[model samples]
Target: MIGREDWAATALAEIREMTTENFAAELESLEKRKRKKDIERRIIEGPKQPWRPTRHGPMREVILTVNKDWFSEDAAFFGDDQATRENEFGAHAVAWLKANFGDDVIHARADRDEAAYHIHAVIMPRATVEIAKPKAKVPTATATRRMLQPSIHPLIENYEAAQDSVGEWFGGLGLVRGERTAAAIREAREIGQTPPKRRYHAKTWKWRRQEELRLKADARALKDERLALDARVVKVQEREDEVETVFAVAEGVSSGAFVADGASGQPGLIEAPVAKETPPSSPTLDALRKRSPVGFARASGVFGRAWQRMFGQARVSAEAEAAAGVADAMQQVAEADELIAKASALLPQQTRTIIAKIRQTIPAIMRRLEQRVKPVLDDQKQDGKGPEKPRRE
Candidate 1:
């Protein structure tokens, strides 16, 4: 359906400029009529309703565009002469306008430059109607006078009748109506030929359930990814803290803050540096020791493996002693993991809150994609353009 957006008065000049010889002449001849001056105003005013807030008045003119692709088919298939049948359709359309609207059909032209061959028509708001004259004294004979007035409703109200007449006119050229088209489909079915299935759109319960499951899966996946990133961050923090601890221990040894008793009966400096402070206790660590012994064991094993790798190539030299000095470094990471587990337990709740906010926006996003993005993609697909080539990462 053409609306205000499809057809505008400003486009009239552009249409005129594109006209062929026949159409140009018709439009030129049409401009001389007194009604031509008011065509824009009448068309604009006719489709308005002051009484109804959202309703529009009827259109003052209508344009009918015939499907151009239909003309490309072999006319013999429809039992018509291949050469002249397409021209007949255009003639029949023009004839119908003249027969129906008469002088009120101010201008009509056929345009060929568009994707489809179409007829553009301008109509004045005038209809011929008959009114009975006042009865004679003895009612011997009644007289009537034809009146011309601004009315287009009669044609709209009798639209089916007009369509039937046009279909009958086009029937001579083998054009079929809706009923005939349905009958043909049934006939094909009887002969074991299947018509293409129609596409339908509806939000069914099954689809709704699937969509719900998809959203839940998306939320879960997002939560898992965030948790993995958090774990990486904790690991990096633990590594930094261990480096600092090693530096502090070395500083203590160099400053003589750490000392060992000599094996002999004399005071002597110790070469092996031992930790001066015991590991700090935390509520989270205490909970893990009491309730999750297996988890604590697994964490200890992971730290032990890291310790082995650090001292794997050490010899019985200063290097070997130096390697032993940093063995206690991973203890801090184990305590940090226990603390992180407690923090991570609260993450699912926070993730659910974030997912709920995102869910609220999905409907609007879907609507925008359907309207703006989907049509372009569909058109490109139909044109054999396929999707754009994927870029290399």
Candidate 2:
């Protein structure tokens, strides 16, 4: 009974009301147009429906945007020359839009609600499509009447030409066309591949809200993963430092660099960090080292090999690090424009620019803050800091 009577009565009623209200404006517009058409025809009433919009309509929308830096909240983009740049860009942008779009641009607005100046426009691409009137029953001397249907204009046929034309018009404004996009398109065309299609972020709450939620979720996940990784890294670092200390003491005792406490009538136990819980740390190693001096040396060697196998090849190579730093510096140098574009005017641009310029030239940015990063392999190598053990593999 409930299913037949009111399964979703509330929802259905709300949907019906919402849909009717949404189309109410369209109905009003159509009625006004119908009255005008009636006056033109000199008739009492117009057809029930004069025009109906099709799925594949002749109407199109275009959005033009200025660089966000131009309209900074705090300070000017070009300092005192900010107004000059804005005026120049605005004049050119308006001229370009009007000239290209003309009277066919039915609905157009310059929106400055955001920091950047942007134009929103709708283009009606109108053309004529002729249809010959059916033959009259009675023959006449005059030719048959013809009716013409509307069609889209040829101006918007080539999208690439429009893109190039806009960039060319704005060439003087320091705002370059999407260089990466153009390069990618050219590369694809040269290789006989289809050029990448341009994409626009949809300005709807439904999609944007979902995207925001997804990004937040991803951030949380990444943060959790980082914390877990940090914990593991801390454990590994502490253990490595302790193991290095043990190796140093063993080497000094064996090489007569320093005498062991046992030789001086002290305790026989070798110094090592004994954890509170029962944990394995080269379990067989301590036992073998207690036997003889030769046994101790062999046991340490065996333990070192075991550690290498367990840890995999995570050795710090200075040459590799240097190469990476050089590559980063070269990349920074090449993207000098990108650095300028990304910097906000709210902050001190001159200071940031100077810093970037300095960094771009340097082969590597020294990470001095991170004192934790040590050259584990280098210290073991010909540094004379520790014993030189023969690598097993």
Please report the candidate that would top lDDT against the real structure: 2
**Tens digit per residue, CA lDDT, model 2, 72-166:** 53234456635555456666766776788665555556666545777766565533222222255764333221111123333466656677778
Segments of candidate 2 deviating more than 4 angstroms: 1-56, 73-87, 113-115, 133-155, 180-200, 203-393
Error of 1 at 2 (Å): 18
> In each prediction, how many residue pairs overlap at the backbone (N, C-alpha, C within less than 3 A)?
1, 0
* Model 1: lDDT to the true structure: 0.45
Top-TM-score candidate index? 2
Could you give candidate 1's per-residue lDDT for residues 1-393 as a string of tens digits? 112443445344333332332233333333434347555554454422211131333234545544566666645455564555446666877787777777556666666645666666655444333222333355423222222233454554554555566677667766654344445566788999986454353333565688789999999999999999999888655543433232222232223332323354232223235443423331232343344454444433443333333332122113333334333333433343444344344445674354344334333322332343335445545776564456799
> Which 10-residue window of candidate 2 scores lowest in summed lDDT?
364-373
TM-score attained by model 1? 0.27
